[model samples]
Target: MKQIGVLLSKNYKLLSVAAILEVFETVNKFYATAGDELPFELNLLASHETIENQKESFGYQLQSIKDVKQLDLILIPAFTSDNMHETLQANRLCVPHLISQYNNGASIGTFCTGAFLLGASGLLNGKIATTHVDASDGFAIAFPEVNLKADRTVTQDGRLYTSGGATSSFHLLLHLVQEFCGNEMAIKIAKVFAIDMDRDKQSYFSTFQPSRNHNDELVASAQQKIESNYHDVTTIEELIKDIPSSRRNIVRRFKQVTGITPIEYLQQTRIAAAKKLLERTGQQMTEIIFNSGYSDPKAFRKVFKKSVGMTPSQYREKFQVR
Candidate 1:
């Protein structure tokens, strides 16, 4: 069993913390034994004993933050809200505590603006980190010490794992479950939650918009497109046509706003899809190749090996058949 310490604050985003808890619960169900030990030990720690009402700028309140020591993982979920004043104050309180946890050998992580807490803690200093896109420019200005990737959903740089937003918490947690436990366990939990066990950055969530605007409608639409059809043959030219932006302008804005090119984003999305297939299904390499949008088996092998540091076959043999 892994000990996960979650640090909570006043008005923290509930979904961020809830999503991670859901995954842990799924892990427990999958790993349950007949009259045996559970697979996870989650501790929710807060500054105070009283549970605080998390203001819903998005939705949900963080129920609590655990108080535990010698944790294997320390997760900082989304803030109560993204209000500058509120967030800065919340971050100030949480960052130092997270650092203390990390120094005690816990692997630190954050979801969305929670990355700001990690940034302020100095844990992400000189590390590649990601946070909510809306906070990109300001975060960059404030935490120039951290190499912030405005585009990525999650980044694992050393013992610190950082993700973008509330929904991205699912992907980040799935990634962690796969890393610590195994791909098989991760896939099982994902299936239990009715999520495609294989969805990743490459899988299509929705369409792409070129504008760097922080409007929720545009960002959500673009994210959905990326999540739903990341493997589509559609080009960036086609992606941005719906938006009032040019090709060069789109590319520049996307990189500046998200810290990645459209093509790179597409590839990562595809790779994430491949990871699910590799972990869950017993399909042959050729079958996974076709389903994940790779026309050629050799090409899929090359890309998969490069991204995951192992051949598709090897990944399955280690995680699936184990």
Candidate 2:
């Protein structure tokens, strides 16, 4: 049987850990029912024997029987923290252990913000990975060496795997089951857990939050204006009118600071506004396009699909309020 370890740390999201264990356990039961040999020996491992549950009251605790070693696969669940830098410092001890495990030929997979912990291990350097879309900016700034694909829900680079946000963990686990077991087992588990088997990206659910954490006051002001006036059909020239910089210089600095060009940022802002209307309103297509500052229907449809990975009507159908 393959040895699998789920590492639980302080402040870890308990539900993610539970979901991983439940999927594997349910698969094992399926194996038994079919008279097949057991495929996994799952264990809860940790850096310490017992850790306080950060999300709960003082009475709750998590106990682990295995240390971070000698496992065929190690899964790191997400943790809750507002400041990632401080959280990483607090959990820095797991880095060397994780590195040792990887060097010893064990595969590592992380869920949601747990990618932050894996990134801390320096193993994700130059590797394509993903985390919660809301945490993409923070992850990029913290580990610039890692390629953060915020749109993808799951990414696998050789033995290293990462999944995006919350229930995306279920998708990642299903992927591993399919890889190690078979499609039949994966499909069985999906039906057993009621998981959507087709979700592959988090782009549809991601909101475009503009990066304003830089010290560039002029660029910050320009961003604010773009967000507030996204429906005004404002041009880049008009955007830079209030700022004392050349168009070329402004575009250059905007890209440097936000990692996206001014026009791209404008498009994102407008699309984000459009998403809100699509989700919450019963407005027609023309009204949404106009309210989101687009005059051309063709241009709006093209940008919406390109940005959201779906058409406006599809997005609305999936997310619109009743």
Candidate 3:
């Protein structure tokens, strides 16, 4: 049996931890009923002997292993924190243990913001990983060496694996099941859990909000203008007219500060506006297209699909407020 350790840390997302545990346990029960041997020995490992919910009112306790070595796979569930830096610093105790486990040939997998801990352990260095879309900008800034594939729902590089936001953890667990157990068993588990087996990307769920945390005032001003005037055919030349820098210099600086070209930013802004309109309003396609500053139906459809991983109609069907 493959030894699997699920790290239970303070401030961890309770539902994710519970879901993962329940899934593996159910699989074990399935194997027993079928007269087959267990495929995995799942354990809850932690830096502490006991972990309490940060919300003391909940009064829940988690029993954890003192030592987490000699594991085939280590799963880190997402932690709840607004400040990624502070979260990583507070969880520093797990860093050395995670590094040691990785060096010993154990694979590491993380769900949602738990990728921050994996990144802090230095295992994600130069490896493609992902996290919650809202946290993508922070993750990229915190770990520049790790290739952040924020659009992907799940990313597996050699022994390292990372999954996107919230319920995407189910997909990651399903993936692990498929890898360790056979396809037939994976399907059985999926049917048992009622998890969609075809979710492969997070692009449909992510909103493309350009990062504006940098100190570039010009870029910030340009972003504000684009956001407010996305319906207008605002050109880069028009944006740079009031700024002191040359068009080329402004474009270069904007790209440096925001990681996206001026045109790309505008496209994202328009798409974001279009998404909101589609979600809340009963606007026709022509009206939404015009309101989103797009005149050509073909061009709008192409950009919408490229950015959203689905057509406008599909996005509305999935996310529109009923």
Candidate 3 lDDT by residue in tens digits, 1-322: 9988888765688887888888898889999999999988877765563444322212233334345448899899998887777878777887888888888999999999999999988888999999998788778878889999988899999999999998799899999999998799899988988988998888888878688678989888878777777787657676557777787888888877777788888898888889999999999999999999899999999999988889999999999999
lDDT of 1: 0.68
lDDT (10s digit) by residue, model 2, range 214-320: 89987898898788787885587776688888888989898878877889989988999999999999899999999999999999999899778899999999999
| TM-score, cand. 1 | 0.57
Q: Poorest 10 consecutive residues of model 1 by lDDT?
A: 200-209
Backbone clash total, candidate 1: 29
1 or 3: which has the higher TM-score? 3
Task: Please report how far candidate 2 places residue 65 from its true position, in Å.
Answer: 10
Clash pairs detected, candidate 3: none
lDDT of each: 0.68, 0.85, 0.84
Which candidate, 1 or 3, has the higher lDDT? 3
Query: Model 3 misses residue 6 by how many Å?
Result: 1.0
Listed per model in order, the count of residue pairs whose N, CA or C atoms clash below 3 Å is 29, 0, 0
Q: Which number leads on lDDT?
A: 2
